[model samples]
Target: MRAFACPHCSSLVHFENSVCLNCGSEISYSRPDRAFVLTSTGRQCANLERAGCNWLVTGDGELCDCCALTRTRPADDDADGLAAFALTEAAKRRLLFQIDDLDLPLAGRREDPVGGLAFDLLSSAHEQVVTGHESGIVTLDLAEGDAGHREQMRVQLAEPYRTLLGHLRHETGHWYWEVLVDRAARNEGFRALFGDERASYADAVERHYSSEPPAGWADAYVSAYATMHPWEDWAETFAHYLHVRDTSQTASAFGISVHGPALESEPEESEKDFDALIETWLPLTAALNAVNRSMGLDDLYPFVLAPAVLDKLRFVHDLVVARPAYVPAG
Candidate 1:
């Protein structure tokens, strides 16, 4: 995500900041302008009238430009005051910035008929809220914000990587594929590689849950669950694309030097080539890990860049840049 500053105080700001630490200015992300702006609306979000959140937004809501989605308020008595709500909003805006910056296609939630994307920052597993929901609306357990809770979930899932940002990226990938790729032209190729997506989804899920991920899974998939179904394959690849782009951007922005022949070529900033991207990414990741080691920190990027994974990444890039026809949902 691009760096943001408090419009009023000009101090570096976080997406979730309600009051500016430097100047005490209120911050709001405009859903229209796709920008963070100073808000005079006190400390509450304008949408609080409709939804329970009192966090600030840059201007009048014509629709949150960030996600192009809306929420009806949470309960007023929700503890953590507005801080929790603000944190959720900030994270969402950061994710939306990546979405917009990438020009990723969007599909809205099934329950909320709004044309824009949706979000569900659920209170927790113990809250009155139900445990699960579907469609374009992502239901994140608020406990996910806690480091210990997230790590526990990560371990339980046996995932190599997990983070709030990663979850947002992965879930959004599913939504994008639902609209952008699940159409016409691209069916044949996608089917050939990922298997026929026309199969019964419930059956596929049941089968996958029962069966082990394909042997040498990383040779063909980014994550093991991606092997569960074609839809998952697509989502994992999409999330990885975001992962590659955003991390590289961050590296470049920080003026970190990336050496080696792989880093020699510049990736097309407008429309990226996946091949060139990986070439740069591999070297850059090595550099990043080296730096992390210097600081006695864990590897910043923990996964290996296998050729099979690269192929999947290419499929993702092809879909995004080619705007290939979408296949029907399996």
Candidate 2:
């Protein structure tokens, strides 16, 4: 997410900030303006206090656009679940911000019950709650909000990175596949890059857990998990696209135009330049990885985008740019 400044004191604020630290003035995100403003002037979401939501409402609605997408959440009696729900909602808002930036179509369950996006933020305490997307409804296992549990799952799954936002972005990919590719009748183009999605998903998941990914999987797939199925490949690639876009914008917002033998240069709207963004992604991530190494941590971005991966990324980029630019409502 791009950095923000306090509307009251000009102090650097963050996307989730509800109160200005310097001026002590309440602030909230105005979706149409895409900036922080005084809470009194803001179209405050009804969930601002209940869910720790910092976003402003977009229509004449009680809930903000992002919060309205949630169809089900933990009950009030579930204290532990409520805590996790807050963190998950925060991540979901960030995902929606990036989606708007990409100019992708978005609608709440009430807008289109059959295929419009919705979320079920379920707690895994009482029962197993798997994180996946189906029929435009994304289900998240609330345990993912616990740092220790997330770390354990990352290690167990051999994933290089895992975060609440990561889960949100990855699952949103599945939702977009239906909206952007399936509903648009662009499956032929999708198949050329992501393979056929007609394969048995059940069998694919079963086979994936039954053994290791084939050798040389990275040559084509963005991640080892992507080799499991065409659907997974699309999701992983789509999620990676978001990672690159958001991080690239963050770097630009911070004036982070740094690379080996290259630093302190101005970013030229990198997100709009797909080729330039891809070009900068590697070197920028390399510098980030080096910084992490200096701090005795693993690489920030462990995977490499091979030529084939780049091709798939280009396809995603094309699909995103195919949409008209997002213009704030009047």
Against the true structure, whose lDDT is highest? Answer: 2
Q: Count the backbone clashes (under 3 Å) in each candidate.
A: 20, 0
Which residue runs does candidate 2 get wrong by more than 4 Å?
A: 260-270, 324-330
> Highest TM-score among the candidates is held by which one?
2
TM-score of each: 0.77, 0.93
Candidate 1 lDDT tens digits, 1-330: 556678787888765565678988767655455556766633345444433332444335444444235343246676552344455555666677776566655544432364335767666544764322255566666666667877898898778787767777777776776566554456777777778877788888898878777788877887887888788888778888888877776655456546632321133443366666676678888978888999999888877767767876787777667644333243
Evaluated against the true structure, the overall lDDT of model 2 is: 0.85
Tens digits of per-residue lDDT, candidate 2, 1-330, equal 678899888999989889998888999998887789998895789887678999888788799999999988999889999999999999998998888766688876777767778999999898888899988899999999999999998999999999999899889899888887887778999999889999999999999999999999999998989999998998999999999888877876787776522221233344556777777788889989999999999999999899999999998888887883222211
Model 1 Cα RMSD, 1 decimal = 4.8
- How accurate locally, in lDDT, is each candidate? 0.64, 0.85
